[model samples]
Structure formats: structure tokens, C-alpha cells
Target: MNRKTLALSAVIGLLAPVLAGCGGSDGGSDGGEAIVVGTTDQYVATEDGPAPLDPAFAYDTGSWNVLRQTIQTLMHVPRGGGAPVPEAASKCGFTDRENESYRCTLREGLKFSGGDPVTVEDVKYSIQRVLDIKDPSGISGLLSNIDTMETNGDYEIVFHLKAPDATFPYKLSTPPAGIVSQKLYEPNKLRDGFEVNGSGPYSFKAEVKGDTVVKAIFTKNPDYKGDLKLRNSKVELRPFKDADDMGKALDSGDIDVMTRAMTPEQVHSMVDNPKEGVQLTEMPGLEIRYLGFDTEAPTAKEKAVRQAMAYTIDRGKLITKVYGGMAEPLYSLIPSSVATHTNSFFNKYGDANPAKAAKLLEEAGITTPVKLTLNYTTDHYGEATAKEFETIREQLNGSRLFDVSIKGAEWSVFRPKQTKREYAVYGMGWFPDFPDPDTYIGPFLDKDNFLNTPYNNPTLRNQLIPQSRREADRSAASKTFAKIQDIIAEDVPVLPLWQGKQYVAARDDITGVEWAVNSSAELLLWELRKGTGTGS
Candidate 1:
């Protein structure tokens, strides 16, 4: 399950003070000008199930950003974890007498973009449908304990879990839990050709497909009652493929913002010093990059081999050289910003010591020149990934305990192979599905776990995951998770390499932008302005 996957509010100070308050600014939209932004289409079109524009079907972050705005959830994370705000629901929670049951009542006047009055049936069906999909998207596994789901009223729905699950609210806060209009989802795919029938502040428009994909427009959902924190009426998402193109776009004034997916060099050059019209800000990301050992492979299953290799590698050099200091070296599965992140692993495996590495191999009953292959995807993270591998190879071989061979695959191809467990060892990067330690640990929860890696920890998978999810309180859940991570560092099925940083550049005109802990590059579209709107 090791797929290799935030903040408090991260802040960025610009060289220029917050743009001056302009008259009739309407979110500082350059005074009545349309605010256009760009990003790349990372996924190419595929015939596979008509491409899951339905967030319920897949939990990719790019998709989550759109879905969270489109659908309604029963309970949500409030501004200060306030009482769950009503959407389709007036308010929802479990009955005191029955801790396992969850319930929500609807708000009035809410309608899907298609104008279907959101109802309890729609909520039940939308949730139940995920189990039917069985790919489970990301929420399926989390929802497995549902013993029953029924609508108590037209606007109210109840879920009876097989066990007490406190994290359920946080789970609902996640986009996959965003309720879909049963009216929009047909049998297996979307009702229309992937166009979202959203209920949020925006509606989907044109989509341009290419190396650099751009979505036409999404204006405020006129019926939006959920969160009006956003300041703009429209949003444009265009992919620049990589940072170089984004940098160029920022420079040429073709795009107003450069956000997300910048490499080390690009970060140094464009983030703070991009061409005119662009403003750059860098923040630590809710992302982590790591190395996974295919325990499914017989040779990799040996704990000694896994441990020895882990001990032998030079992570510091890789971060410094390959990542260009854009990344922070990580010593544990959980990252720095996340609660419960511990340096226990670092306490065990200090900076790379070739002598210690060789000794570890020798003690593990392995002779020098232990040969192995490591795999990575080309163009997935940055140009330096391959170079990172090269640095790793040098470090391992420097210890004279391992002979390393490196291989590269394009992400589209690499994704399937990793899912199939074809590589012996590989580089994996994960963007958190939900901004929680659970999302990080949940993917690699156990083999056949979420990401489908074969690295199963019977104790953690069967015992820990259920144990955590079933807790009556998330604080209690975090307690169990602390022990679970101790187990992770002890086992070392995957090695945590580095924590990534997210960088974004916006048009001086863009506003209402705030950085969440997860590094979502989140913008409440309605919060953006030109001459007539307000960003924050």
C-alpha cells in the first residue's frame, strides 16, 4: 500500500506590500478584467471508465480541488473546526445513545447545478455507490465499516458504522466524501461527458486538451450557500507540464500565475524573481518523496536486505545535491509540519556512514557488492529525480556493500508498473489525499492496502488501521498512530526521503489567496478579483 504521498496557514511576504486598495476593485481583478490562471493536464485522456471526473471514483489531488467545490458533504471542517456547517445538511453528528450511528439534516434552498434538489436519497446513493465502484476511490476503504445508511428525512441521512469511527467527520471533510448529485452519475461513469454537474460556487465549462491543458471557466455557483470565502466568479486552470514552461508563462505574461510543480532550479529562479506580472511565494508542502522496497519480490523480502540498504544509503547528499536544498530531509514517515512526526528513524540511522553501512551488510550476512536495481519515473517530480537516483547509487556503492542499477519510466507507464509491483525498488512521491497523518499512513497501511503495494504489515494493517479508525476520538486515534509510526520506522518497508516545497506565482492582480497547511494552492475562486471582486 505504499504509494508514496501541511500547514497551519503558511504565510508568504511579497517584496511589494499587499496591493493598494483600488476603487471598485472587485477582488483587484485589474478593474473588470477576467482573472485567468493556468496549470497542466497531468493525465492524458483514457477510455478507462470515461475518466473519473467524479471525485467519488478517484482521489487524485488535482481532481479533489475541483470536486470539493462542486459537491456537498454532510459534515465539514469549519474555520476553526467550528460546528460542522450545513450544506445539504443543517447539522450532523452521532446520537449520544448510539455512538456508532452518524446523522445529518439538510439545509433549505440548496440545489445541484442541474437543479436537482439535493436530498437524503442522493446522499445515501452517492455514498453507497462508492462501495459498488470497489476501486473504492480513496474513501471506499475508509467507509468499509458502514453497517447501514438510510435517509431519516428528505434532507437528512444516517450512517451506522460497524464500529465507532471518530475520524469520519474528517473523512467527510475530504473531497471524495463530497456528495454527488445522484442525478448526475449514471451507471458507471458521469452522466455527461466528464463535465461536472457541480453544486459548489462554480460550474464547469470548456476544457482544452494538450500537453498544457486548460479548463475554460467556472463561475460562482449562484446557489452557493456553503462557503463564500472565495472572492471571484470565474477560475481558469492551465497546466504548464513542468516549471520551465510555467516560468516562461509567468515571464511572457501569457499566464498571470505560476503555481505548483516547480523544481529546484525553477524555484530558485522564478519563485522569487520571476518576470514582471508574476508574484512567487514558496511554502513547505504536504507532500513527501520516498523509496519503496518491493517486499513482494523474494530478494527484497529479507528484512536484513531492506534494513541494510536503508542504512547504507546517503539521504543527506541526495537532498543537498539533487534537490538543490528546495527539499528538507525527512527522517520519519510522518513529516515535520504534521503532528506526531518523530525523528526516531534519524536517531537510529544517522548521517550516511559508509563504514556503518558496510558493517550493517556484513552483520546481515551479506558480502560486499550486493547488487540491486532501483526505479524512478522520468519527468514526474523534477529533472533531478534521475540525478537523485544517481547520487543514491554513488552513496550505496561508495559503501562497497551494494551494486546499484537505475531505471527510469514515464509516470503514465511507471504508475501501472508500480501498481503491479514490477520494480524491485522505486521512487514514489505522494500528495496527501486529505491533510492528515492518517492519509499518509493509510496508503501504506498494509499491502493490498490503499496503493496496492504488497508490503503488508499484518499487525499494522489488520490491527493498527482498524484500531485507529474505530477510536471514538481522533485525539485517541493519534495516540495509537504514534505507536503505529514507531512500528513503521522499525520495519522500514519504505524509506522517507524528503519533504517537498510548493511554490506559486500569481498575477499581481490575483487576490483572496491563502495557503492552507496542506499546500493545496487553494483559492476560493470567488475570492479572486480584478476591478470588481475581492480575493480574501
Candidate 2:
């Protein structure tokens, strides 16, 4: 179930602004060819699925995939990754040193595909509506710092913050703040039906459906204004139930691109064994997999018991035996790729030490063979999750200090229940909303984290977090981040398990595979195109 997730947005001052769609090949001159993309059902968006298409309500990757292309955000994590850049905004800057007031001017002549003019009012409505609707699973929490938004004339929008927040701009670059045409959407409720009215590189054309969505067709938005260029006139998004089917689709040329949820075994079969007209591209290791311990749960409430679990599990074995080395062991909440990430856990525990685990349990007055149940989402993570959890069960039981039982819950039920403190110990995966180190640190430590664990240290919740945000220099913020990681290592609120590598299998004739995955590890279908020649 553990795989890399999605990207986030940002603002403070427009740092390193790149013209959207400025550079990169237009997936080889259109040619009116339709690119068929293959993805597992886990990534396909449906009205009946976990998320709704309304920009304000969609939170999962399936929804994000549709939203990112259809709707333009004020800011974006550039295709190649760096500081957040203005995407829809012609210009943006902070008005105060405390990082409270922010302003943005929309690019002139912005218009939705439906021919509605995009105005500051639409931008203001998009931000305010998210706070108003506040879907429990939505990104409203990211906007908690905003006090109010005011629009001036037709193109200017200003945001007033309740508190100083440097990362507020980054949040602006995500889907939660995607500009929606006020004429097409209601302020207090999610938009009904599949019709999308947006001003991005693509527009919703039609959907091919059966019991579930078989294919979603997107055509280029002729009026779209940005740095992106559509490589093909149309994009056909096809959803498969399994990775094996996705791989087979790519091999048979039924699809031009194969996206997320491909298992390691399926990847090896395509890359190692060789598919005549297929190519596999591996992405940066930016995603994390971790185990959360609910502090309210009896066994987990004991610091010694939590520490013992951290000390006993072998992450190396999980990476090698289970993932086949597609991932690397992680020791801190922030993956090593992030600037402030430190292997604090590894520094303390070294490796799986049975003696240390037993000693810690004895000190806590907890007996050996601690019985506990571990939970994981069956549908959200991937098919490999069951094996992954079984490996965890075996590892803990092998320690002789824990008697572990594994359980599965559907994501629809699992996520809300976990947030409600229903699970004692569980596994979860994180995809960054933005590429900042703070994205990793802040959310998990927030008073109401996803698991809503009862561990809250003032040093982390109040002081370090806000202090890190106030420090304008990211490098200066890292010192506070390092300290927090040290604290998390001691607290054992969650144990970092593994960092994942992105995988994309594409037909050899696809020319833009290199640029298909932007800096944020997002698949840009607009960057893909069909080449005239076949297999090499």
C-alpha cells in the first residue's frame, strides 16, 4: 500500500519565477495523434469514488490529476522542481516582513474554456469557498492561516493572514486554491456532475464509461494561456484494476503511457525481461512510508513499547525482500532528499537490536509477548500492502517481544476512522503537497494529525514549528527541523519505514517521457506525444 503520493503549492515572495510552459519539447508537434495513458483504477477519478471533481472537494491523486490540468493555480511547483513559481499570476509578492499580507495580479485576458472571463472575484471566491465548504477530507487546514481575502477591480487579489506563515504561498500553489469560475460553481457546495469549466492546458471533452470509468478524454484548450504546450490534440486516460493489466496494455500498444501503481515485480518484468516497444523510466525517490503509533492506545501509550517497536523492525529486510530494492530505508519523518532530514532514529537505535528492545520493555514494566493489532488501508495503498504488513507482523513476532496481528480496512472507512483514533498502530504513505521540508514536518506534528495521536510536545507544536515558518531562510529553518526530528525519534509518534522511487512505463514511440514527470513527480500528460517510428 505504500507508494509516493502528490505535490503541493506555495507563495511568500515569488522566488525563482519560471514562465509556465516556458521550455521543453511539445511532445513532437501534435500530429493530431491521441495518446492513450494506462493507469490503475486507484488513480482514476469517478463521481462515486473517494473524491468529487469539484476543485474544492477533490483531495486524492485521482482528483488532483484532473484538477491540475483543468484548473490553473496562482502558483505551482515548476515542472523540474524548485521554489514555487507563479503559474496563473502575472506577478505576486508579500507586502510585509511578518509574511502576513500577500497580493497577486492575474495574467491579463485569462478565460475559462467555457468562454467565461476569469476575474479577481473568481480567485477570491475560490479561496473563500474552500473555507466555507470545508469538506472534512479537503485541504482547508492548509488555509488555516488566512484571515480574509479581498479583491480589487478585476485582476488583483489580496490575502490577509491571521498569523505569520511563510508556507502559506506554497499552499496557494496546490489544488485547494485552484481558481474556479464563479459563474460555473456554487460557493457553499460541491459542483455536481462531471462537467469541468477551467482555463488550463486541457479541457474535459467526454468520458468513456461502463460500470467504472473506462476512459476520460481531454482535448487541448485553444484559449489556454500558460507556459505549457499540449503535445497531442487529445489525451485518452484509461484505468486498469491491476498493474499487470497496465503493463500488458503498454506491451500490446493498447496504451501509449503507463502511470502509477505498477508493482516492483511488474516493473522488473517489463524492464529486465524486455517488452519490445516499451520503455521504463524511474523517478526521483521523494515519497515516504511510515508507521504511526496512536498514543491513546494502551500498548502504544507506553513510550518503552513504542520505542521497542521502533528498535525491533528491520527496514532493510522490508526494502530488499518485500520491495525488491525499489525503495530505500528511511530513518526520519523527512526523507533524506529534503534539506533538514536527519537519520536520528538510526543514530539512536543503530539496527534491529533484540537485546535493547527487551531491556526497554522490562524497564517500562511491560511483559514480553505484547499483544497488539496493526491496521493498513487495503484499497488506497496498493496490492503489495498486504505482503508488506505481513512482513511487519513477522518481524515483530520474530522479536519475541511482540505478538502482532494484521488487519485491513477500505480507505473510505480507514482514513476517517484513523483520524478518529480508532487504530492503535497503522501504516500510512505521504505525498508532499509541496516540496518543502516543512510540508513533511508540520502536518504530522499538528494537534490534529491524520491519526490524531495523543503525543504533543510544546517544543514541537508551538515553538519549533512556528519558529521554522517565521525564519525566511530555509537553511536557518533546518536547525529547528533537525531538533524536531530528534524529538520525533525520542517520542516515537511514528517510525519512518521506506522512501519510494517513481516508475513510468511508456511505449518507446513516446518522445516526451523525459519531461512527462515534472520536478514534483507529477505526470504531465501535456508533455507526452506520439513518435512516428516504432520500437528500437
Candidate 3:
């Protein structure tokens, strides 16, 4: 992937005001069998925007939400949650035990939403273009393993890998690997504008663009040959300023569903009050929030100092005081539900021991009252982050071994700066790109990891990760994942804080709320249906 340029921050700064101007009437059909869903996120030149629907350029949740429904991939996480399954292909798997070579054959009679034939050349070109454009912040991390691509016939394609990558197929199932219409997109650059062309369950229609996008329209693709059958004829996506606005819209019957941006307080209120016409679906916990540090920073370079900070922080207190117990403490980088997850950090640090932390600092010859700055985003990470970091500061200061100061940035600015490693220590959250332990461990260990924190553990980066990727037997591979967690705990580059439950609030009458969130934590709009009160 190409290195990201800092210009993205300026581009994102313009988005909020541009989107704030998008206020207008719902402009959607509410009386009939229409379903409207919204998020507070703005459409922008960055990954968050709802426009520029081409898969190569879109990476953030907003773009991924639209792409997951409108574009077809080789495989996908089924609605209601399960393993990745074939979507456009009849089948795909490795033909070699070394995991270096793979092959797939397209389902017969496959065609794009625009009626173009889904040929092997189209598949080959779509994959190659992602590498060619190489948007620094794009999902190219998912495709970095490719060595070469070859095709035998119109329907057959083979992938020759640079290394044995067991999670390669999982990568194919994500938005970054979305197959495109070769006839439409330029092979060397991202397609311009919001006119999307794909072969998924839905097809793109006119976007309601203002200074910001007030709404986006989509209709079922009559030509789509994938296994998924749409329950709704059209999908209308709107954006609200926050969850409170979205809750008001849902209560006022202005929209049928609300997917994200609800604070824990708002969610709890809904659970207790039981809004007459609304139903809240509390999804299984799959998200992780954490603190990451720059290993190369002078303050953090000392291993004992980092470990001291880890042992001193009280995770239980953070969950209760900052999150109000809306989240559970996370002991490992991988969530506990996954088989590969291991509580290495918890095993090493236990609950919290201030005395042990102080001793560690003393042994390392570090002076008392070390200074560190904690950074977080005010808006994107939710309003609770201020409290979360303040709680962290209190926990550290209580030990009397360190002095902590807190700083806040809007997500647009924060992301770029963090990626550039401007902050010595910072808070971040992760939503899985695909459902696998490799998704959690591989990126951070990669030499060009997304964290951009200065770290290069040759054993984890060059040996353990690639070794784990070579195992076709996932059960056997999990042992290597356990080893990885132990190494991460020893290093303490990132301290896992807590895991949060996914929440979706919809009208009580809306069917399929249970199926809306897949195992990967992606929102599947196709699974949603208007209530039986609205005629089918």
C-alpha cells in the first residue's frame, strides 16, 4: 500500500460543516413500505463519506456499509453471523497445502447490476487496480499478500501468493476486496464520483447531495445472481448529528431504523424506558477499545516503564466509572469469544497492583512522577472518552509513579496524526474487518502495520505471524496466536482496555433486527424488512 499523505486531514476538516449544511426534510416515503436508516457520520473525501462508492477508494464504516450491500465479494459473513461463505464464486479454496496457490470458479450466468458479464478478466483487473491505486489508507492491507494472478477461462482465476497466507480468503470477503465492473472503472485509478456499479444484492441510484449528503438511495438489483435474497425493495440512508437526534427521528416516526452513534447512556435509557414504538437489539460484544503507545518514544522505550503503566491502570474501575459497565474488560487483543483469544495481559498484570508498578519503575532506575500525555478523539470515539482518559489519569496518578495529562482531537485530525505517530500515547478502538484472530494479530505485527507505532519485533513480525498464516488447520494455528498474545503482553505497545457490545435500535414493528448485525459486526440492510403492519 502507498504511504498515506497528511493532506487527508484538511480534506476531513471540510466535511463536518459541509455535512452540517445537509439538513432538510426526510424526503423519503414514510407512509408506504419504505425503510430509512441514518448515522451521524458525514460524507467526505476521506473514507467516511457515503459517496465515491467505488470499492477501491472506500474504507471507513460509512463507505463499507454502502459497499457491503451494493458490491459482491468472493465470500461474505452471512447475515445473523457465521463463517465466511462463498457469494459470487461457486467455490474457492487452496489447491496446495503450502497455502501459496489458490483457485476459484465463478457461478454460471453471473452479471453485474449494470448487466455487464462477470468475467475472470474482470475479477483479475479489480484485484490488480487496488494495488495499482494503492490508497495509503485504503484496505490494501487485506490484499498485500498477492504475488500474482492468472486466469484459465472466463470463469476460472488462480491466486499465487508471495507467502502462505491462511487468512487470504477472509480478506477476499471484505469491502477492500470488493469486485468491480472492469468495463467501468479505470484500471490504474479510482473511479470518479458516486455512480457505483456492482453485482451485489443492491444497485446504486441517485444520491441526495447537498453541501453534505442528506440521503442516499438504493434499489434491489434485479440482475444480481448472488445467494442473498433482498427483503426490502429499496434502502434509504440518512445522516443525523448524533444518536439523540436519531432517537428523536425514530420516536417521531421519521425513520424506520437507527444503527450507530448511540452513547451507552442513551442505550441504557432506551432499555429501561422502553419507547412505545421502538425496539433495541443488544448485539454480542465484538469491538475493542485500547491504549497504544509509541514504542520509540523516549518515555515509552523503557520496557519496565511500559509494564509499570500497564500494571497500575485499573480496568474494572474504568469500565464502571467511565463506561458505566456498558463494556467488559478486555484481557487480550483478540475478543474472548474467539477460540484463539488468550488472557495473557490479565494473567501477567492481574487486576491492579500499584506497589508492583512502583517496584518495576524503581528496578528500571526510572524517577518517580514520569510525565505522559494521553490523546483521544472527542467526537468520533463518543463523549465518554473524556471521562475514560481522565479515569486513566486518576488511576496512574493514584499510584504516585507518573503524571498524566489528557488531550483531545476530532477523529479527522486525530487519525492522520496518530497514523503519523505524533502522539506519544493515545486511545483507539477497533472494529474487525473480518471475523478471525488473524485480523486482530496480523495487522499490528506487520512491518507496515496500520498502527504506525514504531515497533518491529522480528520474532512476531517475521516468524510467528507468517508461520501462523501457513497453517490450514485453524485449530493448530490458534496455538501460534496464543504465543503472539504473550509476546504482545511482554512488549505492552498497546494496552487492551475493554470490549463493547454492539447495539441497534429499530422500530418495534421492523422485522429482522436480530439478523441485521452479522458475525463480523457489519450491518446488513438487506436483512431488514418493513413491519407486517406495512403491506409487503
Candidate 4:
């Protein structure tokens, strides 16, 4: 999946000094009280079933946040962000020089939250089920490389790949690869509802209204067997309808920390006029917002139409006017932070030019003021999305070459429709599954891509991606990735907009705010605790 950073002084320093002396305390270590964290993220049931909590279908950040706490993968990204390290497994590595065969040995005495032994069979079953179900909206693509799985004795599991895949271990580190009890989950069907049963740092019980998760209360999983140490005994995750509500909860101390969907205005308020006992923690992020196209749709079917709109979109204007300069204008699917990134779009289109847009349309025999619709989710991204689309509507309309109408839907409705390619052009944001350049490009360009778009190029999907995956050294495949980015810019199936930095607004009494959310944008709820300091 193409997932979803910024500079320090220009962004963070403008916000506030990085809070110092904010350390976790032992006071709350004895199960003192539940630490309530507020987020504007919503988890809803989809056509794939009410399996948002199931590792096979928990593709989004909201679901993964809860899963990361309760579910244990064989390998996981470290708290401070680095290469994957063993979590449930004692050790894991490629068993061959070809990077095709991989093996992992489970840690001794590993058990599920239900207190059942976590055998190698459970590990094989968990991954096999994801491939069996293959939910279009789920993360089956990450595990598509697996040709077969073999078990050795009771503690070891081996994955045989379809081809050489150096990134397989990173894929295993994500929540989608989280091990589950085979008894509780079906072999070919997703386990429904909000109940999560895994061996991780915490165990959770959730409250749901309709299909949306309203609240989730996580207690320390005493049966948990993992490398992570829980800083707080309990964490209650409260979901808000919007940033305003979440911010109010933080201001009134209804929640100790507010994360995920804080608006630019709310962040500015916190930065300029700090709350008495609250502080904003900024960290490097790879989250990105972009527009996806249904290549088969009437107006969008034409390559020139897609190219014309790309020429007319002023990303800098969108970032400055809508985001208040809190985000960077992204020109490639690969964000600037990735080593293989290139400014391919900027190199091709230069800047937003209505004249260039008009010329392309005229050459393609298309009429002026081409009519089209732009779709976006109302609640999932943030409150500013409405204004962000409005800014885009104005930009496209201002060009006098296109007639654009913007449509908004709640995520539950938006996600299914977008995946079905119901909209001619839709907006979506990505939080990377792993820290790699492939995570940015592969998901959108591959044949079994998550976007469900029809713009497939053999060179990108069949050739370059596999070529890049074959090389054990990721940096050595930069030229291949550059070619991949060039094809994406030319195809215009998706247009890059802006990349954002992560922010967590927390009360000074809350520590580990910086480490609470990892580089991949997954919430490490176990990292947060009640602090005894004045500074954040």
C-alpha cells in the first residue's frame, strides 16, 4: 500500500520548542487509572464485513492503532523508528541469499490474550487467512508475495515467496501480519465486530454505535509476551466526530492526549497561544494527501483530461491557503523524505498554468470548461478537508478550463464507493505500512493495486516493481524507482498534493508524547503514561 513529513525550524520551531523533560513516571505503572486519548479517526464496518478489528481487514490507521496494541506481529517497527525487530518471534531473517525464503522462530511461551498457546500453526494460519479472504479494501497486497508457508516443528515458520522480495520482512512487521488465534478466527472468512484477541501490550474492549467504533478501553494484557513495556496500565481511546470536539476534549482535560486528525487552525492556536498545561509535540511524518482518478470514467478516461487537471492544480496554493503552510507541496508519489524520491511532476508541469492546461485540452479535441466531480471524505482526513477541496474547486474553476463540483461523504460511505471507483476523481490520504520508497509507489501502480484504478502500465507493474524488489539493496534501485515515478507522472492516475508532519497535543502531565506515534503513523498507546513534570 502506498502510505502516507516536513522540516524542523520552518514547521516545528514555528509551533513551539520541542518540549523537554517530558518523561514517563512510575506513578501510573501500578494500574492507577485509565489514560484517555482522543482522536478524530473513525473505524466503520465495510462491505468486506464488520472485520475492521480483524488483522486481515484492519488496513486503516484507526483500526491499526487499536490492533498494534492488542495484536503481536512476529516483527515490529521499533518505538523510535528503525528496521524491523522481533516482537513475538525470538528471531527472523531470510533463509536464502535469493531473498525468497524467510524463516522465524517464535519466542518461548508465547500465548494469545485468551491464554492459548501461540504455535507456528497460528502464525501460518493468520497470514494464510488474509490471502484467502483477499478483501479488496484490505492489505492482502502486502502478503501477495508469499507462494507458500512451511512449518518446522512447533516453534518455527518459513515463508516461500513467488519471487525474490527483499521487503517481505518489512511487510511482516505491519499490523496486517499480526498473529491471531486460529480457533477464534475462520480460515477463509474475516472475524467480525470490534473484539480484538491477540497477544500484545494490551487487551481491549470496544463500544460501537451503528458501525462506527465509539470508544475502546484497553487494559494491560497480563498474558502478553512481547518486547514492549507498557507505560500506562490502561488506555481509553475516545473517537470524536471532528477536530473541534477532540480539541475541546483536550482543552477541558477530558482526554490526556489528542492525536491523528488535529486541524491546522487548532495546531496554530496551540502553537501561538499555548494551553496552560498542554504542549504540542512535532515529529517527522510520511503522511500524504493526494487525488486518485477512475481512468475509465467519461471525462477522466482521456489522458489529456487527466494531464490538463494536473497542470491546473496549484499544490503550493493549496498548502499555503488551506493548510496554512503547515504542509509541503508534494510532486511525486514518493515523498521527499524517501531516498528514491524525485520531483517528476514539478519537472514536467513546472507550476499551475491555465494556459498549459488549455493547450493540452485543445490538442486532445476536448471542449473548454470540462465538467467533472471531485470526491472526498468529510470526517476521515480532518475538518479542513472541506476547505481544502473548496480551494481546489476555486483553483480548477479559476482556470476557466474546467467545471468542477465537489462531493463529500463520511468515510464509511466514501471508502466503499472510492474502492468501487464510483467517483471520477476522489481524494485520499496514505499512511505508509512500512518505511520504504516501494510503499509509496507500488500500491497505486501494481496490478493488484489498492486504488482499484484502471491505469496500469506493464513497465511499472510487471517490470520495474519486481526489478526493484529483487535488489537486496533498496538504495541501489533508485533508477528503477525514478522510472516508476516518471510513468506515474505521465499517467496522471493519481496526483500528488501535499505531505504533512505529525502532531500530538497533550497535557504536560502526559509523557512519551513524541514516541506515542511511531514514524509509520501507527499509535503506540502503550508508550503514553501520566507524568509528574511541569514541562511537556
Q: Which candidate comes out best when scored by lDDT?
A: 4
In model 2, the worst 10-residue window by lDDT is 10-19
Per-residue CA lDDT of model 4 for 458-502, tens digit only, reads: 888889999999888877888999999998899899999999887
lDDT of 2: 0.76
**lDDT (CA) for every model shown?**
0.64, 0.76, 0.75, 0.83
Question: Could you tell me every candidate's TM-score relative to the true structure?
Answer: 0.86, 0.90, 0.88, 0.94
lDDT of 4 at 205: 93
Q: Name the regions of candidate 3 deviating beyond 4 angstroms.
A: 1-32, 46-54, 191-195, 205-211, 533-536
Q: Higher TM-score: candidate 1 or 4?
A: 4
User: Model 1: which ten-residue window has the lowest total lDDT?
Assistant: 13-22
By TM-score, rank the candidates, best first.
4, 2, 3, 1
lDDT value, residue 378 of candidate 1: 82
lDDT of 3 by residue, 231-289 (tens): 77787888776777887888798988777767878777876666666777765556788
Task: Give me candidate 2's TM-score against the actual structure.
Answer: 0.90
> Residue 508: error of model 4 in Å?
0.5
Clashes of each: 44, 16, 2, 5
* 438: Cα error in model 3, Å: 0.7
Q: After superposition, how far is residue 36 of candidate 3 from its true place, in Å?
A: 1.1
